[model samples]
Target chain A: MSRLLESFRIALRGLVANKVRAALTMLGIIIGVAAVIALVSIGEGFSAYVSGELEGLGTRTLFVWTNRDAANPQQLTTADAEALADPLACPGIEAVAPAYQQGATATYAGIETSPNVSGVTPEYLTVQSYDMKVGRFIEQDDVDHRGRVAVLGSTPASDLFPGSAYPIGETIRLNDVPFEVIGVMAEKGSTGPMDNDDVVLIPLTTAQTRLFTVDTVRGDYVVSSINVLVQSEDMLDSTIEDVSAVLRERHRIQPGDTDDFQVRNPSDMVETVTGITTTLTIFLGAIAAISLLVGGIGIMNIMLVSVTERTREIGLRKAVGAGKSDILWQFLIEAVVMSLIGGLLGIGLGTAISQIAGSALDMQTVVSVNSVGLAFGFSAAVGVFFGIYPAMRAANLHPIDALRYE
Target chain B: MIEPVIDVRDLTKVYQMGEVEVHALRGVSMQVMPGEMVAIMGPSGSGKSTLMNMLGCLDTPTSGEYYLEGAAVSDLNDQGLTSIRRHKVGFVFQTYNLLSRTSALANVEIPLIYGGVPRRQRRQRAIEALEMVGLGDRLHHQPNELSGGEQQRVAVARSLASEPAIILADEPTGNLDTRSGKEVMAVFQQLNRERGITVILVTHDPDIARHAQRIIWVRDGLVERAEQVGDRILADDSQGSEEDKGQAVAVAALDASGTFEEVAS
Candidate 1:
């Protein structure tokens, strides 16, 4: 124990004698550890943000879209959507909303902006978990009567009316077709690649007959997609199966053939995106780990140089009765001390950098305890791994040859 | 009869220099009784340094039986040789070999540290060793802060701290001037006479060789002759007697002139 303490003192003195070289060697480890922490924190924050966005829509919600890649492409209709709402047909399903959408420029007071013009029923708000900001959403009476009424999402409302004037009771033009704006929706924000707030909602009947007229193949209006809200989170999988069965029967898909439509669970998408993001995080960490590998090499390089420089010292110590293990431990401890100190400083610097970046980018950054432990442990391992060769080189030197080293 | 401090019989050392074998020592035999100060003198390549290394336990002889303080050393393993060196042998080098940035006291404590001496006892012994070499006041000074002779004295103190049975000095004052060399020799002689410690000096200088009670001459890897000096030169006028106060004053005077004469001469 006393000999070990003495070796520590000797190692410390050796490092202190060459301050610049020692500090430079430690810089490699510092940068490597810092990069690992900062990049990982940012990556973790991104995945968390995406998961939160997906959770906002509710886990029980599922989206069904027409699959254009099917051998016989099928179009989803309002009739098929209505059929899914039958309680006996889909007991797990609570509500369903059918929607058709087209991108067009919206104009009010000569200000023009692009927004998705969507035709949806009143149940769209319930199924999508959206609340009204001021006035009521589209009702069944408006669809039956084919009333030229519209509801503005928060983004289109702001775009059409830059001033704080009430958007209700105002007339807006969509693709040169005028419609009365009856209500302004609350903010739903954006998720993935689609912006929920950049939309203008109208009655299904009015949009099909007046603005976007299509040839009636089966005397039914077609919708782009259908959103189904399940009764509970636990019933979501059964509800998706129920909806898939309904759509498959409606599209006349054969038992041996693939379905012409796809039912998507929002939670599944969250899992997949989270998986991708986690992979991205690990890839970033591995890239940072390459720098750590280089840092280990740097330590090895410096230790080798130190061994060569202190050959005479090694000889002198051996002459004074220091054993091989003593010399080996001395050099090994010096290397570990350098890397461990660098790891600590890197953690502090990395945490600070991540916090600053998080606030600047307006995103959450998490510096988990696991990442800190991993980085610290890895740096120590690197010290031991790299320190071995040089320490052995020093220990194995014949005392006479070492003393004679010029 | 007192057992000899060192006993060697037909010791030989052969070095493999790539494709050639160089016989450095060939069947050398010698012994030194306890408390005797002896010098091994030879020109370069005469195996004097190799013999010193063998005696110091830094290297094992290729062939023969050797014993240090009555224990057989020729067949010991590396660990045993290190243990023998730690407990029974202390080495002083031509270059002083003190750690450059370390204090004189710390340098002196190194051998004791390797010997696993307790910290307090190590410090006490180191201080005593420094005072033994007349450098009690220079303990905290680094090798760079002290003169060449002072550094050599620190090295001597380092060797003495372990309380080894024998001190092997290889050209101990080679780097110092005549004054520092005489001071170092005086320290060795005083340690031999007062503490009854056995000391061996390896040098080619006749002036340095004459300070020892006996001289062993080596030529071409073999001992040429062994002789006793009729009139040996005392390194200092106050060396033969126990005069601590007078020796301190003389050391103080030498300390003042220690660095000056080396630069001038």
Candidate 2:
């Protein structure tokens, strides 16, 4: 035990004697570890952000879309949505909202902006979990009577009426057709390609008859997509099966034939996003790990030089009765101490950088405990691995030859 | 008669340099009694350094019988040799060989550390060893902080810290001025005379060799002569004569006649 302590003291003194070299050697390890921590946090934060966005869209929700790649693609309509909404047809379904959408310019008092105009029924607000900032949403009476009433999402509301807090009861023209804005949606922010607040919602009847005027060969009104809300998370799979069966029957899809529609669970998108981000984190970490490998090589290089420089010292120690293992331990402990100190400093710098980036870039970054532990552990392993060769070289020197070294 | 502290018979050391085999030592036979101060004198390439290395247990002879403290150490492995060195052997070098930037006390403690001496005892023994060499006040001085003579004394203190049975010093004063050389030789002589520690000095300088009671002349890897010095000079330049002065003159005559076995007998 005392021998080991003496080795540590000797190693510390060795480092202190050449402070600039020691610090430079440790810099490689510090930068490598810091990069690993910072890049990994960025990747983790991005995945977290994606999951949060998915959560806001609701976990118990499923999207239904027409399979345009099918041999005989069928248009989705409000009738199909109403059929799926029947409690006996799809027992686990809580609500169904079929929406038809088109890009159109909305103008108010000579101010115009292009927004996604969606035609939806009263159930749309409930299915999408959107809240109103003012006035009321579309009612069943509005859909039945083809009322020219509208609800504006916060983006278009603010764009068309900047500085105006009360956008409700204002008359706006969509694609040159006039409609009254009865309500404005609360702000929900944007993510990726879809802007949740850049929209205007109107009654389906008015959209199908007045604006788009598109009718199928069988005289059925068409919609772009349908949003279905399950009663609970556990009922999602069975509810999808029920909805698929009902839709296949309505579209007259034959057995063994591909269906003309798709049912997508939002949770699957969350899993995909998580997988992509995790792989990205590993890739960035691997690149940073290359720098660590180089740092280990630097340690080995310096240790070899040290052994050569201290040849006479080693010989004198041997002459004074030190064994091979003692010499080995002294050099090995020196390398380990250096790398561990570097690991600690790197952790501090990494966390600080990540926190700075988190605030500077307006993105969330998480420096997890697991990552810090892994980085520190990896640096120590690097020390041991690289220190062995040089330590062995020092230990194996013939005492006579070492003593005679000039 | 008491057993000799160091006994070597026909020691041969061959060095394999690339393809040529260079013989460093050839059938060298010698012995030294306990508490004896001996000097092995040789020119460069005369194998005195190799002989010193063998005596110090830092290298093994190619083929020989070496009994140190009456134990045959000729065939011992590296571990056994290390243990023997730690317990029975000490070495001093021409360069002082003190660890640079280390305190004199710490330098002395190095051998004891390797010997696994307990911390408190190691410190106490190091201090005593330093004080023995009259470096009592210089215990905390580093090698650079000390004069050439003081550094050599510190090295001597280091060698004495483990209390080994024998010390092999290679040109103990090769790098020192005459006064510093005498000072270091004084410490060695004091240790040998007072502590009964056997000392072997290897040097090419006849003046340095004159300090030992016996001188073994080595040439061409062979023992050319082994004879007692007529008048040995103490480290303080005081001259003294041995009781075996008549026997030494006879040995010197036999060496002149090339009858080496008669001197050994």
Candidate 3:
């Protein structure tokens, strides 16, 4: 141990003697490690943020959207949503909310704007997790009575009402159909490409009768799609299977017939986004890895030069009782120290740079302990691996030939 | 039946240069008793350097038995040879071979460090060695900072610091002036006399060769003759050592200074 330590000190002295060369040698490793950290951190941050946002839509929620067959064009109805809520019929389903949507202008005291108006049942609040900012959402009674009451999304409420107008109890006109605003939705921000904040929600009966002029006696309550919430994430596939069976049965579709509805899960969305982020990280990481490879080669190059330059010294040491292994270790330790220091500096620099870039670009950046350790350990391994060739060359030199070197 | 400090019998060294074979040494047999002061004299390409390397354990003989202090060194492997070099022998080179940018004290400490001496003791012993060579004041000075003679003295101190049984000097004074050469010779004589160190010098100068008790003349891969010096340099007789001989001899092979004639008349 003492002998190794002595060699380490000697190696440090050798490096210290050539300051510029040592620093220049370390530069490659520094840049390589820094690039890896920055790219990896950004990628991880983006994936995490995206996954979090996707999870906010609820992992167990199955989206049954309209994949309308061009031949039939069979639209969904309130019966499909009601059929999915039966515990014995749909084993993995917890709740179902079918919605019919249309574009309509909401006007309240001269403040007017065209926003998406969604007609939904009371289960929409529990299934979609929409928090009430003020007043209450539409109840079962409102849907049954075909009451002319509406719920405003944050953006629509703000736009359709004057400053501090208290949207609750205020009467709003949707396509010239007057309705009292019973509640306003809490701000939920943007969901991917959709602006959920700029929407209006009302009873399905009201939308079917008062807005779309559909007859309840005919019972053809056309809905764009239904939101089916699964009981648990583990049973999401079975829930979709059960819902598909029920919907097919309810729509009176025969065997081998193509259904007009699609059952999708948020996990698929999460996978798509996470897949893109991972590919981007790996692509950038590969480029950074190439730089690391270049840095390793640089270390090898410098170590070779150092061995050649110190040939006589090597010979002298051998003559004075140092062994070949001793000489090999000396050079190896020098290379490792150079690369290790570079790795540490790169970690610091990369973290700082990524944080700065994250704030500047208004993107999330995460620096984990695992990433730092991985970079540091990899750089050291690079040092050892690259240092081996030059160290072997030094160790292979004969004492006599080396000593006699001019 | 005491064993010789250095023993070699029928020693031969052959170098293979592509398809050609160069014989550096041929059946060279010699022995030096313990505590003997000897010089091996030869011109360039005469196998003296090769023999010096063989004695120093830096190279293995092609064929022959070389026993040092009763151990068969010719049979030893590279690791064994390194052990021999580390503990049994010390070397002084013509160029000093000190690591540039390193302090003289640090340079001297290298041998002891390799020998596994503790750090504090290594420093103390290196200082003692430097002081012995009259360069105690220049311990921290780098090689480039020191004069040629001072640098040579530092090399000698390094060789002495190991406390080896035999000191092998290959042209120790070849790069110095006459005064520095004599000064180095004086230090060698002092160590040989007081500390009872066995010293072997490889030299081209006849005057420097006379400083040893005996000299071997080598020519064309063979020892031509062994000569005992009629007048040797006493350790305390630096002033009386410059006596001029009134004759001429074949000493033209070495550097000629218009001073004392120490060659055979």
Candidate 4:
């Protein structure tokens, strides 16, 4: 222990003797560690942003959209929407809503706006992941009675009624027909390329009959397409497959005939997002790891110079009875100390940069404690790995030659 | 009457630089008794430094036997040689090779540290060593802050800290001013006389060699002459008396500078 302490003192003295050189050497490691932390944090933030986008799409919602059959333009119907609600055939199916969308001009007072009008039942609130901010959404009674009541999404309501004192319970004319606004949806941001909070909703029957005015309704009346809400994420895939098979049978489509409907499971969205985030993390970690490599190389280069500069000292210590292991350990300790300091500095810089980026870019910057651990561990490992050659060179030096060195 | 502390028989050291084999020591034999102060003197390239290195166990002889206090040193491996150096021999360099950034106390304590001494004990011993060399107050002073004489004194103190049987100094006063050189030589004399530590100094200066009771002159890698001085500059009667009584004739002849001619005859 005394010998080790003496060695440490000697190593510190050697480093202190060349102040500018030592600081410059440490600079390489510092930059390397800082780069690792900053790059990895940025990558982490990007991944979180993507994952948050996927989460906004809803957890247990399954989307069924119309796949136009070129051969038969009139394909999906109300019967297909009703089949999804059957408890036996499609187990764990929570609720189903038939949706029909049409672009139309909405007018209130002097304002005129073209909004995408969606026709849906009360269950459409659950399937589309809409939450009411004021008033109520379409109820079962409204759907049964084919009421001409409407729900305004935050964007359309704000646009048409721009600071109006009354929005909910106020009547808005859709294509010259008056419909009472029953509810206004809360802000839902946006989902990738689509804005969910921009549309207006009314009962499916009212939208199909009053808005579009196609009596036979063709394939578009299957309420544009059925929205199947599953009870949980675990039942999603099977429910989607069951619904697809039933729809195929109902529409009498042959195998591989390009069905007149499309089945979309929400879990696929989650899985796709998870895969992307994992890849992003790995990619970011790899780029960050390059800094560690550069830092290790810096350590090696500095240690080599240290060994050369301390040749006479090594000789003197050996002449005074220090063994080869002693010389090796002294140089090794210097390298380790340099790297450890760099690692700590890197952690601090990385965390600060991540916080700044998180707020400035409006991204989720999650700095993992494990990443700190990994960074420190990597720094120490780099110290050891880079320290070896210099330590060996010091140890291998002959006391005679070392003593003779000027 | 006492067995020699160091025994060398037919020792030779050859240095090969590229193709030339320079014979530094060629079939030289000598003995140094315990507590004896000896000086080896020769001109440049006369192989005095080579002999000193071999005696200090810092280098191995190309051929011959060397025994330190009865243990054979010539056959010992590098680790064994280090142990011999740590426990049985200490060295002072001409340049006073104290670690540049270290304090005098730390420099002196290093040998003891390698000997596995505990920190407290090493500290105490280092202080005592420095005190003995008259530099106890300068313990915290680094080599750069110290005078050439003080630096050499610190090196001498380091040599004494390990309590080795012999201190091999290669031109201990070479880099110092005359006054400081004399001061350093005085410390070496004191260590030899009072502590009964053997001192073997290499020098070409007759004035520096005058401090030792016995002087060995080397030329062309061989011992040209060996002589004893009758009156050693020490208050310790034991070392002076023992050296005087045993080789009185040799000492008398060397005191007159006639011993070299007699040995050549």
Indicate which candidate wins on lDDT: 2
TM-score of 3: 0.90
TM-score of chain B of each: 0.86, 0.90, 0.86, 0.89
Predicted complex 2: CAPRI docking category? medium
List model 2 lDDT by residue over A1-406, tens digit each: 8789988988998999999999998998898888888888888888898877776777899999999889989899878988999999999999999999999999989999999999999999988888999989999999999999999999999999899878888899999999999999899776446888999999998898998876663677998999999999999999999999999999999999998999998897888888998899899999988988898888889999999999999988888888999999999998988888888898888889889988887789999999999999999999999998999999999888998899
Worst window of 10 by summed lDDT in candidate 3 chain A:
A213-222
The residue-by-residue lDDT of candidate 3 on B1-265, one tens digit each, is 4456888777889999999999999767777767768899988999999999999999888998899998899999889998988888989999999988889999999999888899999999999999999999999999999988889999999999989878999999999999999999999988887887889999999999988877887777777666556333332223224434511122322322111122422
Q: Which regions of candidate 3 deviate over 4 angstroms?
A: A68-73, A86-88, A159-166, A212-219, A249-259, B230-265
Model 1 chain A: worst 10 consecutive residues (lDDT sum): A208-217
lDDT of 1 by residue, B18-37 (tens): 99999999877777777878
Per-residue alpha-carbon lDDT of candidate 4 for residues A245-308, written as tens digits (9 for 90 to 100): 8887877778877767777765576678778777877787777788778878888998897788
- Model 4 chain A lDDT-worst window of ten: A214-223
Off by over 4 Å in 2: A68-72, A86-92, A103-115, A132-136, A151-192, A215-217, A238-260, B103-105, B117-127, B136-148, B219-225, B230-265
DockQ ranking, best first: 2, 3, 1, 4
Name the lDDT value of residue A123 in candidate 1.
87
Clashing pairs for predicted structure model 2, backbone only: none
Q: Per-prediction DockQ, in order?
A: 0.61, 0.70, 0.68, 0.58
